[model samples]
Target chain A: MRSNTRKYRLMILLCIAVTFFVFILSISIGRYSIPFWTVLQTLTLQESVDTTIRSVIFEIRLPRIIAAMLVGAALSVSGAAFQGLFKNPLVSSYHLGVSSGAGFGAALAILLAAGTFAIQLYAFTFGALAVAASFGLSRLVKGSSTLTLVLAGMVVSSFFSALISILEYVSNPLETLPLIVFWLMGSFNAIRIPDLINITPIILVGIAGVMLIRWRINILSMGEDEAQALGIDLKRIIGILVFCCTLSTAASVCIAGVIGWVGLVIPHIGRMFVGPDFKKLIPMSAIIGANYLLLMDDIARTLTTGEIPIGILTSLVGTPFFAVLLWRNKVGWS
Target chain B: MTFETRGLSFGYAKDRTIFENIGFSVGKGEIFCILGPNGTGKTSLLRCLSGISMPLTGSVTIDGKDLHSLSRAEVAKRLGFMPQLHSSIFPYTALEVAVMGRSPHLGIAASPSERDYDLAWKNLELLGISSLAEKPYTRISGGERQMVLLSMLLTQQPDIMLLDEPTSHLDFGNQVRLLELLRRFSKKGFSVVFTTHFPSHAFQLSCTVALMNKGTFESVGPAETQLTEENLRRIYGVDLCVEYVSKANSRTCVPIIKNDDGRGVGAR
Candidate 1:
């Protein structure tokens, strides 16, 4: 037992180290092509760096990198929590329709020629509203069983998706249509320091809240009756988890558009590393997720002169990886 | 703990009361067995007693304190409930599942400590299933799962244990072992309340037995007196004989089966 704890601790430390390395590498290899040593020197506040290099590192590359990491960590952790809470491995962070609602909100803002701030605000608000609608719908239909909530989420997701389709169809195809389409495809190219500042606290708080209550998630995965018998305040714990997951997932979508697959795939990878004990799985998912998204973002910007939207990249990368995981039969829900 | 229920009734809807105005009490170190036919609300009754479901009327109390007023943790600390069937999605180790019994004792944010793990291990060891500690709970057999759940409840260290049809899925030997363990725990001064379909189990324990039918207990008394041939016939709608087995020095229930020749086999 002691050795097992040690092994998990060592594995987590290794993941954190890899995340750190990925973070620095992502900052160094952007469009401006700063060297590794100069990136290191600028990060350390050295006197030898040029002003343009420092500003490029701080103002552009650093913010985008941080946003990618935060979004990745938030989505992945939320996904893991949702999977455990719902007791279904297929569930992702967006299972509650946050992404669809946020997509519609972003599309609406872009169609109106709103600034990034209004788009983000609209996205976050609607994302929360969508989940609230799902919850309310589930409550009205029956008691809050996981199956009912999942169905309600699907209903809301399709509803918002239809609304998005309507908005896309009515907008100017040449101007507003393309802008809305690009934003929905997702990217970190538009992320700035202010955007990072806006979302960092919410994401961090969400992550921290999940980490604190992660052990309870293991109890929840045991199923509702048993968990309640074990003395968990089921309503309170589930409420807290949904709120935290919604906060982080909505904040992630607000910045990164509808980046998919990180939440679904990363937690499975984390489980392969550590078993399904959420105490270990949650932190492991956060670190691996942060690294995975950062690497994806790096590929997005550098793969071509014309940047690929991260949503496209994540799907392209994540689908095959997920398939490989499935083919190997190592998703580990059994 | 002296656990009691007063006029407890439960139903899914206004017109459908599964059980109504039933009451009973269990003292320390006593074994109480609830025997009833299928669809007799045995599981629902256990749920109400465990506070998983609110009773439609009346109240359950532990040592004169109403159970509804206590927090879930406080209720859990005083009472442990083992469910009939557990379906696990993730492949958590048996030890991990066992350690979850410590949740009510821990703070909201706390995971089980090493001490808690030790207690869980001790319970598993006590149950003679320590070898299953590392096995994935989902991969283990049904009997082992029940034993693991029992170990988990033992780790909970509650004064009273409520189990819903605990022996229903066990093999014959596993059933005997489980009953023996319950008897041992009762000897050790823990009150045990379990629902089962087996009247023989009641005779084996020689404990308090309640035969429930329709929406109320048909009879609640010592196993020897309440588990008579006529009462068993009435509750089960089957012809059964209750007789002493000289070889085992215990009474057993045997259902009468008719041969193809219309001869009554072991009827009289």
Candidate 2:
């Protein structure tokens, strides 16, 4: 038992190291490439680095890199929590329709020619609203089982998705349509320091909340009657988890557009590394998710002169990897 | 501790009441066995006793405190419930699953400490299944899973243990072993309440038995008195004979099967 604890601790340390390595590597490889040493030097506040390199590091690459890490960790941890809370491996961070609602919000802001901040605010508010609607709809049922909540989420997701379709249908095809389409496809090309400043606390709080209550998730996954018998305040714990997940997920979508697959795939990978105990799985998912999105973002900017939207890359990369995991029959939950 | 319920009733809807106006109490160092046919609200009664589901029209009390007023943690500290069937989504190790019983004793944010794990391991060792500590609970046999769950209840250290059809899925030997464990625990001052389909189980323990037919218990008394051939026949609609077995030195109930023509099969 002691050795097993040691092994898990060592594995988590290794994952954190890998995440740091990826973070540094991502900062170094952009359009005007900076050397690894210069990137480190600039990060350490050394005066010997060139001003252009420092500006590029701090102004462009650093904010986007931080944004990538936050969004990735937020979505993945929320996904892991939701998967455990719902007791279904197929559930992702968007199980409550946050992404669809945020997509519609961003599309509406674009239709109104709103600025980036207004778009983000609208997206966050509507994303939270969508989950609230789902929860309220589920409460209208008799028992309000987990299945009912999931079905309600599906209903709300499709409703917002239809609203998005309507907005796309009526907009100017040449101007607003393309803008909305690109935003919906997802990108970090426009992430700036102020955007990071705006959403960082909410994201961090969400992640910290999940981290604090991760062990309870294992109890919660043991089914409703069992958990209640074990003395868990089912309503309170589930409410806290949903609130935290929604905060992080809504903040993630507001910033990064509808980035998919990271939440669904990264937790499975984490499980393969450390197994399904959420105490290990949650932090492991966060580290791996940050590394994954940073690498994907790096690929997005440097793959061609014209940047690829990261949502496209994530789906393109995540689908095959998920399929391989499934084909190998190692999706973790037995 | 004394676990008591008064005028308890439950149903999913207004018109479909499963059970009504039921009342019982089990004290320390006693075993209370509830015997009923299938779909007779046995599981529902256990759920109400464990505070997993509230009784529709009455109160369950633990040592004179109304169950509805106490917190869930407080109820769990006094009552440990082993469900009839557990299907875990994740493949947690047996030790991990057993350690979850410590949740009632720990704070909401706290995971099990080394001391808690030691208690769980001690219970597993007590049950003679310590080897299953690292094995995935989903991979173990049903009997072993029951032992693991029993070990979890032991680790919970509750005064009253409520189990719903605990022996329903077990083989013969496992069933005997589990009943033996419950008997031993009762002797050690734990109150045990379990529902089962087998009347022979009640005879084996020589415990207080409640024969439930439709919604309420038809009879509640000593197993020897309540589990008569006539009551068994009326409840189950099958002729059964309750007699003493000189070989096993205990009483047993044997159902008398008849042929299509109404004569007993293999009759002399």
Candidate 3:
């Protein structure tokens, strides 16, 4: 019964509080457990804190947590925007073939390159290009044809995935193959401030663009013809949205590998709060998604002695959560 | 505002022609009915006049301006449209669906104004289903959905309205009720173009009737002049039966003439 602005504000407050709670828990729960007071001191760099606790918290946990939260927010927001654009609940931010495209890019990078930065760059560029190609091809075939777009996405995904496997078969098994496989599963580890610094602007700009056009996104969900009839140049709106979503999603994929279900699930979860209104759904998903991923990462690192791939842990957690949601609600594509 | 099409002909694709070299026009304050059977390019023609689709060989002008040249928002500002068989395709509420009609009035990145909500609510109230505004559009009855559609179009507040088979899905009572509403809309100098198969309904309500045969207009004129027994028999391929229904409080209509041998001519 509350107005949209009130509901939106309340959701934001809730997200902020939950995110703070998760941030505290994320720093405190690792193998080297610290007291709440010491964790606070370590965080605020209080004079009483030990050097080891402070170094461990700031150097190791903080960057990983930040990366997880950023990746989570990026994927989910991208997913939410994508689901709204296609008007299909099943589509994620990666539905435009970003994952396949990015994987192909990464494979080529590792195959040809010598180091970490080069590999990341390879995945980033190729992944983005792959998505761009898929979109360009879809545009060629899809003229007011939603079905054609879906079909074109499928064709592009299948083609790139094949290229990825082919690249996998030819690469050196000990070094490049494991890296590609691990990258495919996704990870969050050993990331310094530079990785964080690199993707921050892309994520921020993409999120801002989506938020600015959120109301127009609501009209876009009414199907393209209705949007056009209402004076929305659908091509223009869709063009910008695709760039925003694809950039965030590809950037997240660059850092996190292929963390599967955040994009697939975040928008659906956000809908439970606001009844599919994007003006509320997008922001809520971002906050919730950030917290959700950080929490999952906390569990992943804490439960195991050595680091488990974040992808493995997320799949282990996310699949069951998704199943419960689907069982409770009749999850139709529309 | 009046809308007139000067030789509007359209096609679905290069080889697939729906309309071939057609022309029609409507003046202000007139209930102009275009009567045609299914797939006689009725919907396509409606799209063409609404400026959603372009004509293949001719042009349609609205208030002396060419329809094809105007921006869609500009066209929408002056025109309201009701597409036949619009399944919501998502779980939008009747209110949400109706509010989308106001999109033409909003600038990019702008929320709808209070006047937009007021117009939608007023239209819903006029349609007598303001209480059902929060209901899911797909969950409503066929007739009720039809009324909701009309309410949405009315909310557009366009000086001209175009509908394809406006009364097709409603029951007899609501069908007549909506026809009456359309009559009133045209009477208020809001030019209205509607396509229907019911000749008698057109005869009772419309100021003009346009009968489409094959892909072109066979006849266009006042209903009494065009919708004759011979025309009905030829168009519908029925032996044209008309019945009179008695109404309340001492009212009677002329009895219909039946076939002398009681053998009605059956359509092959």
Give the number of the best model, judged by lDDT. Answer: 1
- lDDT of each residue in A203-298, candidate 1, tens digit only: 999999999999999999998888888989988898899999999999999988999899999999999999889989999999999998999999
Worst lDDT run of 10 residues, candidate 2 chain B, spans B259-268
Give the CAPRI class of candidate 1: medium
Model 3 spans with C-alpha error above 4 angstroms: A1-5, A37-48, A142-144, A332-334, B113-115, B241-268
Question: Runs in model 2 with CA error above 4 Å?
Answer: B259-268
Best by DockQ: 1
Residue lDDT tens for model 2, A123-224: 999999999999999889986877888999999999999999999999999999999999999999999999999899999999999999999999999999
lDDT (10s digit) by residue, model 2, range B134-226: 988878887788888888888889999999889978888878988999999999999999998888999999999999878898879999999
Give lDDT: candidate 1, residue A186: 94
Docking class of 3: acceptable
Total clashes, candidate 2? Answer: 0
Q: For every model shown, what is its TM-score relative to the native structure?
A: 0.97, 0.97, 0.91
What does candidate 2 score on TM? 0.97
Give the Å error, residue A178, model 1.
0.9
Model 1 chain B poorest 10 in a row by lDDT = B259-268
What i-RMS does every model get? 1.4, 1.5, 2.7
